[model samples]
Target: MTSNATSSGKTVASAVRDVFERIYGDPLKQLESLITATGLPVYKDPKTGALLWVDVRELRLRFTLSVNKLEKFIEGLRGGKLMYTQCRRCGAKYFPPQVDCPRCKASDVEWREVSTEGELVTWTVINVKPASFSHQGDYVVGIVKMPDGFNITAWIDADPKTLKPGMKMRLVVDRRPGEGYITYWFKPAF
Candidate 1:
């Protein structure tokens, strides 16, 4: 069987593709026929009585994201440091650093290192993850309110039961487990 790349460094063999088509193709074709007959792409669930709309068009987006404006942020992660952008005109701050100031419409900004400590404001345990991230298993995602008055969303490397609102969390940048890529996370301070 031939293999084809579904994504970067990920391949699906022809046999697997054929099996998937066999499993799902019939229902999809039936749905298409229903849409053609009804002139509407809506269906009602038999068990839940919920109406569902299926789009006639399928969009697959794959593109490269330019990080030219936030090069410092990327470099900071490689150096085990986190950075943010602050507007020189309005004194506003932003995480996931942006070069343009949307508030004042000024492109002038400076990059600054982010505080290492923050307080956990909210969190959630992600039991069902996206296909790309399924390999990592269940994980905790949290929003930490940093000392600088900005919140950063990241994976929390801790037990969910042990976490509480207002608990101190320390930002960490290092190689992610089993991924071999440098990324950031938050962990309980105490």
Candidate 2:
């Protein structure tokens, strides 16, 4: 997670490629023989002169989030509010709210709208990103504990250097780009 301004300026994927280049140097493709014109996925280590395995398997990820008990949360998002549930019996609260009570063994819960104020607990610059998040620019991910002591994970709109733990922040609901869905985020406190 070292940032040198130049390297830090590059995208996550390009940064990873730079790391590979530093370790292995550049790999040149070789056309050693034309055995009836056949293409293969094989390479040899330049320094070791040993054969290396090229993985052919590719991985992709997508999830189907269930909104059964938490359907109200989605509704609140559309209504321009962040909502969560509190166990009526035990007074325990949920951030990514759930319907059932875990501690009190009771399903009695109350859905409440979360306030917009928060204090940053921890954060990181998303210099490296997942495949799906690649299109988004390098962003800040942060954990913030609201006044109720429930933690919410979301992107933070602020400079990395200016970001610090225990700084006041505020929640904002915005329409996510491309997907066009309302999601929550944070900004430096007023």
Candidate 3:
């Protein structure tokens, strides 16, 4: 397999392209199929038995992100380390990583590895997800207070019923499966 290809033997871009093709194959034919399947552009939910209307309008979005200022943070992820930025002048730390120190009005900042240990502040379970995350089961998002006095928000890779505030948490660097991108998340320390 090529370096850019995933274990499934398809590049991430190709997988996304396939999904788009399936969703938008001849709009008129899709509408006809839907109408024939349900006798109209409406259907009854299997679980709730509520009538649902099918939307004919479709929106496709593709965008690019500019990470020029936070290049070091991305590099740290590639290197298997979690990094944060700190203001050299006033000792202010940033988790999302800021290029300039807003507190001290100084551009000089220090890049350092973050401690994996943290405390869970709060969390919530997302039952209804957006289109992109619909494939996955319900997930819990949490805010963790790091030792450096900054909070990082990420998905908690654990059961939500067992979580509580002030519980020990650890930050971990990992690669997400479908999108195949490096990211960080929190998990129960013990």
Candidate 4:
């Protein structure tokens, strides 16, 4: 069996999948063969004495989440406005808006629009990209402090060399290229 570490630019996930395929041949066929040979769908670990049961089948599940509570926030994004939820009783603000206020334990929350301008607090360039966002190359993600006492994190649309702490940034909301989905980012205000 190959070690957990991968080489030759292969990701650890891909390397682990390759090792499993090499040992098992085909997933379903291997499970059936093991059951037929051992009279049980179980196998002992090579490194440990622990016995493991073979799964009968593999299931891939996708969930559809309901956004009923944050519908106004979504609508605000669609309508070119950034919205947040504020607690009516204690005056606590929430971005990625929640209907319930955890701090005050109150359900009395109101939706409000956030300012389009913010000050850049911090940022970093993503060099090691995840598989899903690998195509975006090395991108800058930053946290900006808004005047409303809320900090928002998003991709920063600017040259890394030109970015500095406390720089003014403007919020932009539009459809992401190639994905055709609405997303927000921060660009240098100056």
Q: Spell out the clash pairs found in candidate 4.
A: none
- Alpha-carbon local distance difference test for all models: 0.83, 0.76, 0.81, 0.80
TM-score per prediction, in order, is 0.69, 0.71, 0.75, 0.68
Which candidate comes out best when scored by lDDT?
1
C-alpha RMSD for every candidate? 7.5, 8.2, 5.6, 9.8
Q: Which is superior by TM-score, 2 or 3? A: 3
- lDDT tens digits, residue span 122-171, model 1: 99999976544555569999999999869999999999999989999999
- Please identify which of the two predictions, 1 or 2, would achieve the higher TM-score against the true structure: 2
Candidate 3 clash pair list = none
Clashing pairs in 2: none
The candidate scoring highest on TM-score is 3
Clashes of 1: 0
The C-alpha stretches of model 2 lying farther than 4 A from their native spots are 1-36, 39-61
Clashes of each: 0, 0, 0, 0
lDDT of 3 by residue, 1-190 (tens): 1224346654446656766566566765857888988778876778999988878676668889899888889899988689999998999898888978878799989999999899999999999875556545788999999988899999898999999999999888866555566788888998
Question: For candidate 2, lDDT tens digit of each residue in 1-190?
Answer: 1212233355444654555555444332233232224455466778999976554463535478778878889898888789999999999998889889879999989999998898999999988876456556899999998997789999998898998889999998756543344688999987
